[model samples]
Target: MVSKRLFQSVAEQIAELIDEGAYPPGTRLPGERELAEKLGVSRVTIREAEIALQAVGRLEIKTGSGVYVSERKPASLGALPQASAFEVTEARLMIEAESAALAAHNITDEAIDELETLVNQMSSDDEGVANAADERFHLTIAQASNNAAMVHTIQSLWQMREQIPEVKATYEAVCVHDAKSRTDEHRAIFDALRARDPGAARQAMREHFQRLLESMLEATERKALEEVQLRASQSRERFLAAAKFG
Candidate 1:
């Protein structure tokens, strides 16, 4: 089946070539423009596809050199920068709100329909499917903005969201408890985009992140408290044991 995302499709093609030994491990691939021409895709798509491949350890990108196929796949999270969930949420609140507003002005009927389908997927009982849909829904909005920079920035933010262990854990904790709210917020954002109301779209996106940020804060505090309590209990147990020996 064809992949919905262009970059993903390109990445798959590149992986297939590597697997077929057309481009063996440690072999540097063609430059972006050359690869774009070969694949019939844009340079931006080629870049995005390479980044995706690198994230999965299928490829390695070197500055001042070129992209190379990796001999082994590494743990994805270990390669990402350490970012807290709060930091990522705050960044998304600012950037994605603008992205949503811009998308509202430029989004087509096709993108709107795609978002609606994604929202439905977000309602699925399978957590993995719903989470994947949520990611695509946001990316589709980013693409609809008709801004390459915005799409790249949002894609980076999403990489942090999915690949950073702490960020991923916090989101999972918050989302597991309030899946309905999460789905509803996405639907609100989609509705605003479909209506072509930039202000409403911005507000919806901002509100989504605002709630997420607040939830993360609450979860963090609760976690800290639980850790403190756990340590105190352990200390108390040690004290009682010593006292009994005395």
Candidate 2:
């Protein structure tokens, strides 16, 4: 008999297979018999796992074709490094909240001075330098955590930092308020850190990230939907024009 954890583990593995374009969105998975044979699980366990995944909006049951992966990628997309946009934002929010807590408890005058220096050098005037300094400011707080592991998260953070420019630009193209929104939130984070109130710092960071995360997710999905609709409209127009000419 497969343990519950083992069954869940296999289920997550199958989810990852779908997320990495192995199955691709809207593609039906193999039949229960094939999946059971391939993964060495009973059909009963597979059915249970499928129900769990389907409940999470990861899989869509196609009546006769098997399980089709939905557009939303699930946690099975690997360690989040290879995750979808939604997963990446969620992971960042989680890590950043903890980093803010550490900053609140452990930040010192020295760290603040370092932060101010970094902030002073920050130049939205120069987009490239501004982006790097923004990253440096966040990493500084993580370092103030006095946790080597947190500081060593630089490798993953680097990817996040690099993505910030494009993400920021995308938002910029959409609205005028994002820059002020970012600055205001960062200022709150710094203030909370200076107060040495861990709860306040964490909450401030959490709320800040929550707003941005929601904005990013909503905007991305809406934009994709809009693009699809726009293309559909154009296609219809072309079909009408061709009918008139022919």
Candidate 3:
């Protein structure tokens, strides 16, 4: 089975092929089903790869028309800066902490009820629904702050988080691991807002992000260890193959 990382690898491979003129500019690439079969990956993986390539300006999707190779390419494959999950959490700490404080002062009962709904949704076992609910919860807090600028800024940050494939992938993994804790953190913030305690709200928001920071660091360390193990395994396989040949 193709792993999540393979989606990115497939995107890179498709980009390289485009650069080599396998699919020239304006030419429609194979359909998602065809690409999935050709690449030995699921169609969902193909879709994700196409989205990543499209984000980096390597491909263009047309409404009703097929996906086409872009005439222009990014300066390099590294054109998009990879934002670590830790960095995103840091930014959220700065922005969301204040937003929570303001929300404590300005939030309405209706908004509080909506937040409760979101929190419930986030606690569900369905990862997709939980992820969406989590995003909505944060955005709702920003909205409840009654500051349009804060809302816009928070929305922009979320958009930037999604645009970077690495960040998205890292957070997806983190969400799976930290979903229950994250939902509890959201409830803490909501409780503070319900009490109209600005200080408590801000502190809860900061604590939530602090936990996220630690989790992201742990995730990064785990990824590094996995990579090292994979390299060692490959090296051992090569050694065994060479010995057998000898």
| Poorest 10 consecutive residues by lDDT, candidate 3 | 73-82
Q: Candidate 3 lDDT, tens digit per residue, 1-246?
A: 635566688898788888888899989999989988988887756766776566556776543366899776543433444666677778889999999999999888877887888788888886655765677678778868888678656765675677667788778888789988999999999899889899999999999989888888899999899999999999999999999998
Which candidate leads the pack in lDDT? 1
Task: Please provide, for model 2 over 1-88, each residue's C-alpha lDDT reduced to its tens digit, 9 standing for 90 to 100.
Answer: 6244444666797888876778888788888899999889766567556644654557754332457787764433223244444555
lDDT (CA) per prediction: 0.84, 0.66, 0.80
**Count of backbone clashes, every candidate in sequence:** 0, 1, 0
Q: Is candidate 2 or candidate 3 better by TM-score?
A: 3
lDDT of model 2, residue 81 = 44
Please name the candidate that would achieve the greatest TM-score relative to the true structure. Answer: 1
lDDT of 2: 0.66
Q: How far in Å is the alpha carbon of 178 misplaced in model 2?
A: 1.3
Worst 10 residues of 2 by lDDT: 74-83
Better of 1 and 3 by lDDT: 1
Give the TM-score comparing model 1 with the true structure, all chains together. Answer: 0.72
